[model samples]
Target chain A: MMAVVTVAIAVQGNLFAVVVLGSIYSFLMATALVALDAVDVAMTEASVGAGISTVLLLGALHLVRGEEQKPRGRPWLPLAASVVMAGVLVYGTFGLPGFSDAGAPIHQHVVPRYLNDAVRETGVPNVVTAVLASYRGYDTLGETTVVFTAGAGVIALLRRRRRDRRDGDVR
Target chain B: MRNYLVLRVVAKIMIPFMLLYALYVQFHGDYGPGGGFQAGVIIAAAIIFYAIVFGLATARRVVPDWLVETCLAAGVLIYAGVGLVGILLGGNFLDYFVLDRDPVAGQHRGIFWVEAGVCVTVAGVMLKIFYMFAGRRREDDDA
Candidate 1:
């Protein structure tokens, strides 16, 4: 947490800072996932979040310069809003389960069986895969659809407007 | 032009080995930390390397836009098609027990096919994005 805060502070005034911070946060989250025994999720986060997202963002940065255009609006409203959000989130966390509480409802749920028997049933050593592909396969299917949708969106966005106009002109 | 020669030679040497490793990882995921996603990225990275080295026109010639689109569709179709097969065989959706007489073997079969589909889709998407970005960069460079 302290390291994340320091990194965030270091990147406070840069556009690429957000990307760096996000990548760091992702890697940290991947570590957290590993601690939680979700190795597959951790792997995905490490690869997709830390690796791919950073590279994609860098590519985008190459196209669009990373320097911030000077702020043209009053900062108070946004600052106050963010503060309120932070406060509410912090307050909400007070009532939430403490980390690593063995007696927590989450620990007592059906997930324990998933953690234990996933390998035996799915024949996959990665419990995350067993759960993702077997237990919640429908959700995974939906995720695939979302990815397809994003791909379609990119194609649509990147389609040559001039090409369309040219086709119309020919017609 | 000077850098191109080096990139082309390195890519030529590396791509085949990288793709071979991807296939290996995809097939060996049942026993290791590798899977469809890893294989997909590795393969896509190789293609991106090829495009960067040999030029987008050449890369696209090797793997045309239509092929990428088809791969994207085919992956999803394969996944859904398998589930539909299960349904047709009188089981719940994706219930692999109906895929074969033995339930365990059926699960393996289901996972293998689905992972393959995932690999295809992911690789296509990655290459698609790389092409988009690289094409954009080329346009910018030209201008």
Candidate 2:
């Protein structure tokens, strides 16, 4: 199902349909994450990817042509590079521990401590929240800063365009 | 959308529930899958839905640009303020353990404020982006 949506998005010429299809792809990906038991990730994917990005893309479509333009030339080098990167990524995954292995290095490390003592230490029933907001406070702060920066960037770009247009009118 | 009575009625009914759910997710994140980020997006989505149905100008009137901008900065301030308080309490930066008389209570307190900060900032950013895009179209139409 996800693959079908991705292929449709890739081949679609209408920008609106492509945006909608991309959101569908994100929804499917979020469902896949839930099936994999990453509920937090699924929530983020659903909200950011499916919900917000779709609106942003549709807004962008309004500012530009809806139909995607045909490529001026074939992208042989980029295709080859993508293939090589895919192959390398596939090769790299082979070195990973088996799925849900109890003795995986990751499980052996901080997992035990978090599971056994997170509630006692942070007093939060949800270990994920405890880890994110308390144990990993600095990292969460940095993530918030990044989101702030993105908002600032969008404001700069969008607001400045309006200002420039107004100045041009004055001239 | 303005002429479609059914659409407007349904949106009117749903918007409150959507906002309520966002609040539930925000405060209940400590025990569930949701957190500030998800809650923030949900809140913004509700507003955006309202804007889509009732018109952008109406939505803007409800949530003014200045308020949204304030939220964007205040959230970051709240997060950093908590960290500063921790330092003043004679602990390291962002040391939740020193937030209250009891370390466990302090942890809870710190997490609550930090999450609140995250919620505020995330909601602000999402709304800011939406306003910029929607307002741009309105300006273009005016010109």
lDDT of each residue in B1-143, candidate 1, tens digit only: 32777767877899999899889878877766667777777787777667767778999999999999887777777777778988999999977667778776777778777777777887788777777776777766775
lDDT of 1 by residue, A1-171 (tens): 837655674547676887888788888888988888766567678767876667677778888877767679868898899889999999999998888788889889888999888776767776655565667767766766666677777777776743675587789
Per-prediction DockQ: 0.45, 0.85
Q: Write the per-residue lDDT of candidate 2 for residues B44-76, one digit (tens) a residue.
A: 999999998999889889999999998898888
Winner by TM-score:
2
Q: Each model's TM-score?
A: 0.83, 0.98
Instruction: Give, for candidate 2 chain B, the lowest lDDT window spanning 10 residues.
Output: B134-143
lDDT of each: 0.76, 0.92
What is candidate 1's TM-score against the reference?
A: 0.83
What TM-score does chain B of candidate 1 reach?
A: 0.91
The model with the greatest DockQ is 2
